[model samples]
Target: MLHVAPSPAVAGNRHRRQMLLPWLDAEGQRRIRESTVLISRVGGLGGPLAQSLAVAGVGRIVLFHEGALLDEDLHRMVLMHPERVGEPRGSQAAETLRRLGGPHLEVHGFDHRITEDEATRWMREADIAVGAAPTYEERLLLNDAALAAGKPFVDAAMYDDETHVLCVDAGKSGCLRCLVPEPPPWRADFPVLAAVSAMVGNLAASLALRILAGAGPIPWGELVHFDAARIELTRVRVPRSAGCPACAAAERTSR
Candidate 1:
């Protein structure tokens, strides 16, 4: 079970500044404090996403990332400390989030490859799910799990000189597979910069926050892409695929 604060008003005043925003009043803050988020892989993208969610005062964060810290990971993963290079990434990320999130926030870390079974179980409990795994296999699993659980899914990926953010409302909007039916034949290892990944992570976090707080339209079927080299931002409409296997299976089961 995820531990959360009793109320935003009594949560050590960490959210005082954010509470001032019109959309994020006391009620909104309380909503944020009561929500639980699941992030897969606290690496390039998930690291910054988790940080922003923590600062925004999310109630609980369940992180799943299996691996030891690598020298390359240190470049973009802000939560991984320099001294803990040889340690487990998931444990380190959970520890850092707990420290930064303070008494009101609860963080759980699991250092294991997330199987389809595990994804389904955890996504059932998560208010929102984030896909930041290095591989497309994990990303697809997260998307399907979120669809089954009827939760919003946010995914971000970085290429050599560009990054993309996809937000889906499950049944109502197109999902990852809908956007890209199959994983493209890309290199297993890709190039990325800390700044670009952080930017994408922050964007994903913002969308998740809006969904949790009911502050604005959640960008249900939108894809936001940024060109790191040229500094360009573009938005595209993400149409739901009528024949999406994951979604179609759910629709059939519901019927």
Candidate 2:
């Protein structure tokens, strides 16, 4: 169903040959190359997540985030540069990914926050939607859009030394709204360490690749939590909410 032409340079496949071994075959790699991913935010969690997908040869990536780069952002945002502090974070992240991912990778950077209309349109274009926004409102908006479009949504979050990642398969798994129910009290400035965020981001990226490439079974509807201080990883299944308006709408559309 997905078709992607190889780059003119032989180096494209050659560049990713290391991953083509025991697990991912040539066909699997092609699937990954043809898929498009939508990542919300280029902050700590989303930055490394997008970078991992780009390096793994995901063909197209759409990034949505608002505001200019702050000097404080550099503490955890790996894709940002100190010189581009006043510039838009989304555009800067796109530039960084382009340089790291080479010529064949297509990266679209929106320097503003995504509106409801934009979310609907972009989710339709994305094979998978990743939410790493700092706010629950943005994450829930993305979740609704992804469910409406019947696309898989990956949610990544970090608070202090704790990291959480969840994958939602529309019509098959519990959605973000089901997990959070209502937005909890959250601060704009949350404590996070670079290493902790990157670890969680990479974990989210791995899960996305598995879904896109059909490389392995994905733990859909399960929330994965990692505590850096405790040095432990745990998984718990999340139940679909019967009263979730977003999920209810998605269900109605599917019928």
Candidate 3:
């Protein structure tokens, strides 16, 4: 069953956007057509990222966000138009994405919070997960889900002018656990401008497709940071810790 625009209740046409998404070869496109990604929220960074993923032709995108759209969110998550201001965020994003793309893309909007169990379930169905949530609480839950489900993940964050996309391999590549041994610095209002969010989020979506299609020499488990304010780009090694919780946990369970 395919996902369509305006998100009709019926399953969409399977071969709708066969011509677009030319980044991959025939085989790569074929793989994308068969893949599924579960994005936690379709707000802020996740909005454009999910849209690009749909445009790039991910088979299905299961979106989970619990609230309705607020007038304030229209600033950065521009997909939510004034008309859909009061609708469920996930529904609005799904509708907009479907309309922008086509039925070949599948967008499932869940009106529930992404709890631990829910995250794991979504990760189970996803080839890779993208964590663009604004909080470390969400990131940690995402990490556990990816690790337990053995799915690769891409963690992206934006703070005003600076943004980064960190690719995670659960137990293989340095997961988020490697970078921060303790809780991430909690920011009540993460300083992310729309421009910076769009830049980094799109990169995350781009890298997600590359990982899925096995395209070129993949830059897996690397931290790509961009300071849009300064027009700078930095590639840093994804740090791994000897006592990282996820890695140590995986090893302990394996042993």
lDDT of each: 0.83, 0.85, 0.76
Per-residue lDDT of model 1, residues 215-242, tens digit only: 8867677888889899899989988898
Candidate 3 global Cα RMSD: 3.9
* Residue 103 alpha-carbon offset, candidate 2, angstroms: 1.4
- Number of the top lDDT candidate: 2
Give the alpha carbon lDDT tens digit for every residue of 172-223 in model 2.
7898899997899756678888898899999999999888888667889999
Better of 2 and 3 by lDDT: 2
Q: Lowest-scoring 10 consecutive residues by lDDT in candidate 3?
A: 1-10
- Give the RMSD in angstroms, all C-alphas superposed, for model 2: 3.5
lDDT of 3 at 123: 77
Clashes of each: 0, 0, 4
TM-score of each: 0.92, 0.93, 0.86
Q: In model 1, which regions exceed 4 Å deviation?
A: 1-10, 249-255
Candidate 2's C-alpha lDDT? 0.85
Candidate 2 local lDDT, residue 47 = 95
Q: Which residue pairs collide, candidate 3?
A: 3-106, 5-98, 5-99, 160-191
Off by over 4 Å in 2: 1-10
